[model samples]
Target: MDFSTLCVHGCSKRYDTTGSVSVPIFQSATFVHPGVGLSTGFDYSRAQNPTREYLEQTVANLEGGADAIAFSSGMAAITTLMEIFSPGDHIIATDDLYGGSHRLFSHISKKNGLTFDFVDTTDVQNIKKCIRNETRAVFIETPTNPMMHVTDIAAVSKLCRENSLLLVVDNTFLTPYFQRPLQLGADIVVHSGTKYLGGHNDTLAGFIVVSDAALAERLRFLSKTTGACLSPFDSWLLIRGIKTLAVRLERQQQTAFRIAEWLSKQDKIRKVHYPGLPSHPGYEISKKQTSGFGAMLSFETDSKETAHRILERVSIIQYAESLGGVESLITYPMLQTHADIPQQEREARGIGECLLRLSVGLEAADDLIEDLRQAIYGGKANV
Candidate 1:
């Protein structure tokens, strides 16, 4: 079946008991066993739930992975992956990562005795140089947050394979609709389903997809042990959201391309970071790795004051941290998302005070541009 058809009708089936078209929310925390020696595949909700299982299977199918585990949040999924390694194990990751993930690596995991080295993974040679005998995994986020830097997944995966290290790719920005890292040889693919997979801004969910059955078993066990399983209700919502992912992303990507082009022309904007833009540094690499350029874009205003004023003036676009929703969201990463990082570190990564990240929605291209124009011009005049 085509991806479009699968979105509407994928894992949803009516049962004889309820006769409901939507996948019923199995709200029970524990399922009854047939007998003392028999089991029904699901013994407890923490370990598994029918609704979450549906979502897991659907996401696994979408990403072309053998199995998937849904988690309470994106960070939870990432934490579970980190759990696979011990205190002394080393991890090589991209320098410009999601702020929350950076916090986890720099603070939480560091406290736990895990060592991490952040490098520019876009250059495979740099990544190769950073790898050590103790390095157990390579973590990468392509079209990296804020900067939109693209890394060659295939090159990194090949490096990890040769060294017997795990390769984990965060596919939150692109989702499975735009990019499948497993096909590019990544060992594990993670998503903040709260973003694109949820579509609406109402739910927070995460997922991990693995091609290796052995690794799947380990992750599933870790998820169960940590009690980070996604709620049945949220799982149902995620499943529903995923059905329209293809269409929603298609429209969102189109709007993003238009917005990127428009933002590039603005005199107040210093630079636009979007893969769809021809002048973007990662445009060529993105063209080879992703099916589409995605809907997230970031630009720097003339100064910090101008950036804040523009953010305050925008009426339609909300000033929020999260992305990949139907409604447009604007965020100051250096303040909202990456605030925990020291100023020096953020500046080193090019996440400046004037940087504004925008997650394009399904809104009309002209309307969005007009809203941005008014906000920028009005804010500048007021200043």
Candidate 2:
């Protein structure tokens, strides 16, 4: 079946015989036992819910993975994933990461006895230099958060295979619609389903999809044990939201390319970091790995004052945190996403006051550009 069709119909296994088009939410906390020696396959909501199960099947199907587990949030899924490694284990990860992920690694994961090395994963040689005897896994967010640095998944996966290490890829920015890391040989694929998968700012959900059923079982054990599984209602929302992922992302990226091109020509903009543009360093690799350039892009203003003016004055795009929703948002990386890192380190990583990340939405290209024009020129929105 086509991916778009699969997104709508999923595995076509029905729990209830009601023949309902929309999967019904099994909102009960626990299920009644069919018999003393038999089970209905679901004993409690914490272990599994029929609605969440349906959604998980769809997500696994989308990624071409053997199985998947849904979680309350992306961080919860990641934290649970870290449990697979024992104390004294070391991991290597992308330096340009989400603030929350960095906080988890630096403060929590480090304190828990696991050591990590942060490096630029775009060059496989950089990753090779950081490997040590204790290294257990490599975690990366391709087209990395805020900076938009793309990594060659196939290259990294081959390296992991040679070392017998697990390779995990955060497929949030591109989603399954644009890229499938599992198909590229990643052992695991993580997603903030609250973003493009949900396609709305209305719910929070996460997923961990694995090509190996054994790995899926292991993570699922940790998931239910931690009790952060996605709620039945949020599961339904993600299901509905994913049904339109194909169309939503197509429109979003179309406008994104237009805006990225326009920003590159603007005098106030210093540099635009969008892979869709030929001038981007990652453009060729992105074309090789992803079907689309994705809707997320970041740019640097000529000065911090211009960046502040655009954030304060933009009317069409909301000046807020978070991305990959129907509504466009512009956020300051220095203050919003990468603030957990020290100022000097953050600046060295290319996240400075002049940098602004934009999540392009379903807005018309010309309107978004004009709104940017007014904001950049110091005119009022009403003017």
Highest lDDT scorer: 2
> Tens digit of lDDT per residue, candidate 2, span 305-347?
9999999999999999889999999999888888889898899
Error of 1 at 258 (Å): 0.6
lDDT of 1 by residue, 198-255 (tens): 9999899999999999989998899999998999999989979988999999999999
- Candidate 2: deviation at residue 353, Å? 0.5
Give the C-alpha lDDT of model 2.
0.93
* Candidate 2 local lDDT, residue 197: 95
Q: List the residue pairs that clash in candidate 2.
A: none
